[model samples]
Target chain A: MAAIYSLYIINKSGGLIFYKDYGSKGRMDTNDSLRVASLWHSMHAISQQLSPTTGCSGIELLEADTFDLHCFQSLTGTKFFVVCEPGTQHMEALLKIIYELYTDYVLKNPFYEMEMPIRCELFDINLTQAIQKDRVALSGR
Target chain B: MQFFGGSEISPSPPTPTTAGNNAHMMYVFNRNGVCLLYREWNRPLHTLNPQQDHKLMFGLLFSLKSLTAKMDPTSAEKGNLGVPQLPGQGCSFHCFRTNTYKLSFMETPSGIKFILVTNPRTGDLRETLKYIYNLYVEYVAKNPLYTPGTPIRCELFNTALDQYVRSIA
Candidate 1:
């Protein structure tokens, strides 16, 4: 089975900037995705505040019975997260690669606005390619 | 012979205290979002008032449960997002980990929720949470004076809980 089910990217201010589903059985509408993204952002921040020690970076992984959610927050506070089947390996590496793709195709595009919904066609095409590559590598292994 | 005796009797190398102070805090909330118990062992920060803190924690759990249910891949019925779900109705999360801490959650069939915040490096705590539920059942649930849905104030329960948490932490 493909490891990743879906992906979401949230802007620094807790706005859902992008969302894509990679053949997940449970598909969410746009409004639902938006709500989920902002809710996750709040939960992440609250987790940081609820930390007993200093330097906590917020929630990075959530493990459910059937799936796992892995999140990576950039230095600029943008968050990238993937929901995948339970016990999927190499998710952190995949998220980092997605971040790189975002930087290259979306951020570098002169027409792309900062902290806004990602509408870059190049980004969409490259993200698909990257995800497909990962899927193929998994199947080969 | 003397060296061998010393080695054998040296308290087994102090048993390696590598698991130092793993638990940070815990919350026990009954159904209807009432926090029945709150305990802290190593928390160094308190940003919100106790009431507000409990409310936020409960809210987080509520939203997360619904979200997980709505996103269940194996289930055909997709419930409305953000709606409350009955216990055991959804694919509930066991825990979440951040850089600093891990939050392990459990909900009993009776709708009692248990949340344990621990060190991020702590391993899977599913069994530990089950043990904690057992503790609750023994101490508070069976106590004649204890009232359900109220803040837990039983001294025996608190003592037993502290001792158990310390042992595991």
Candidate 2:
């Protein structure tokens, strides 16, 4: 529910098209974020390749006490990551809504070319709505 | 008026054109009673009257022929955008039109060009564009079929544009 501090989208080739860190000094450096995106992209690809033939591929979840990382890989090799506080509830629904946004606003936008980072205004607006809704729900209002 | 995406406007007649370039033209059609086309860039358009509180829907629409024609000599004005159907034939174009002024489009090689038909006293490009951007976010976008360059026909978009137009009227 806390506004997403930042978001990174990694292409199949591991290039970063969109990156933003809001309201924090711990802003991820562009180079470092790119490197991390690329690394994660490779890791994500490798994980998919190593998956048992019958099931879905890639790293679906990675967690620590302070934070959690969620990766969603589309059929075309684009990966969407959501890093949030570890204990956030209803994470599945939240991620589903976020993925819907990625498809509708990001992928569908003519301005947003595939395998590139997101830059569409609609994408951010919908994302903010989804996150804000979750935050409000978490607050028990 | 600002140009964006795959639409083009034909050249206006020899008179002093609302669009700067002579090549700018409008693809006009009748719906209900008003003429419609994709709003072009960099042209003066009609403004809504304040007391009437109307909504104006405005944006860009593109065609593959226009896209290819400007880029490749072999493709100018030829239907080559690959869609089997005529994309712009009845598409609802949003323009703010008050009795005193009307907004319109001018076609160019780059994208759909905008032309304003406003009384000089009641218009400002920056403010109009800002209002458009807000409307786009609040209304056009909320609907699913409002794709860029695709003719919009949803009642919601019409209602919103009408509201804006009425407000200014």
Candidate 3:
């Protein structure tokens, strides 16, 4: 069964707020993942400028030979990056749930600062459970 | 928020009467979730309250869209069920399809939903829905008297919709 490689979230300032590698090997080191997040942030901006339509909604999907990368940017500018197996179903739902969790676990925390790294244990646990449940459901098992 | 013009929404539930089943029942909901225009032709049963039923229908579509997007193996373009009839789209299953009723739904970018319920044998109504949308845009949207996010009460729109629905019915 295809699996999620990693998930990264970058705040509006292009700082990596949340990162996780669901795979055992944890494909890339922390430095590489941070670079990847910042690079994607610039790429997303460049793509928007290159868009012919002024009302373009921005990049939604990135397809590669090995994996499918889905990016969902909320209205508030917090972007959720998900790298998963190709042909994953209900990706939009996943992004939405993640955003909701961020609002609840990260943003709602009084000690949490806006646009900072997500360090909430509740967020971590909920995200893991949500991803596992979604993976299981996707496998139709 | 502006369900019916700028005035405050009535505290009472929108119970605008019941629907008649005459092989054709069409509902036009504004973006504010108000049942602006509900035209029924040959409707027989009044078992369900009209306003309550409209709310329920809207809620059902909401859930159906989420479920369809969740089931879609390739979900792009704002959670559209590009490949429809997935396992989760059905709402009331098992006993839901005892008759020959077909429900076709189309949503415009502006968030207005057009629902047409007809015979199960009815052909694809996507194009027909588009045509109806055009009529709505021209007659209702363009009308200065017709406020946005409010029930559509334009005479021309109602007449045109009635004619179009009759021709297709």
Q: What digit string (tens of lDDT, one per residue) describes model 2 on residues B35-70?
A: 333333222323333212111221112321222122
Kept native contacts, as fractions per model, are: 0.69, 0.00, 0.00
Clashing pairs in 3: B20-B43, B21-B42, B21-B43, B21-B44, B22-B42, B22-B43
Instruction: Write the residue-wise lDDT of candidate 1 on B1-169 in tens digits.
Output: 3422322322221221345656888999998999999998877668889999999899888887887887776666677877767788878999998877789999999899999988777788889989989999999999999989899998988898888887774
Tell me chain A's TM-score in each of the predictions: 0.96, 0.79, 0.94
Residue B1 shift from truth in candidate 3, angstroms: 13
**lDDT digits (tens) for residues A87-135 of candidate 3:** 6767867887888888888999999999888899999999999999898
Best-to-worst ranking by TM-score:
1, 3, 2
Q: Which candidate number would show the highest lDDT if scored against the true structure? A: 1
- Measured by TM-score, the strongest candidate is 1
Q: For model 3, state the Cα shift of residue A130 in Å.
A: 0.4
Candidate DockQ values, in order, are 0.32, 0.01, 0.02
C-alpha lDDT of candidate 2 relative to the true structure: 0.44
**Model 3 ranges off by over 4 Å:** A24-26, B1-169
Q: Report the C-alpha lDDT of model 3 over B96-126, residue by residue, as the tens digit.
A: 1102244567777666788776644456677
lDDT of 1 by residue, A1-141 (tens): 767888999999899999998777755889989988998898888877776676777888999988999998887899999999888888888888898899999999999999999999988998999999988888788
Worst 10 residues of 3 chain A by lDDT: A48-57
Better of 1 and 2 by TM-score: 1
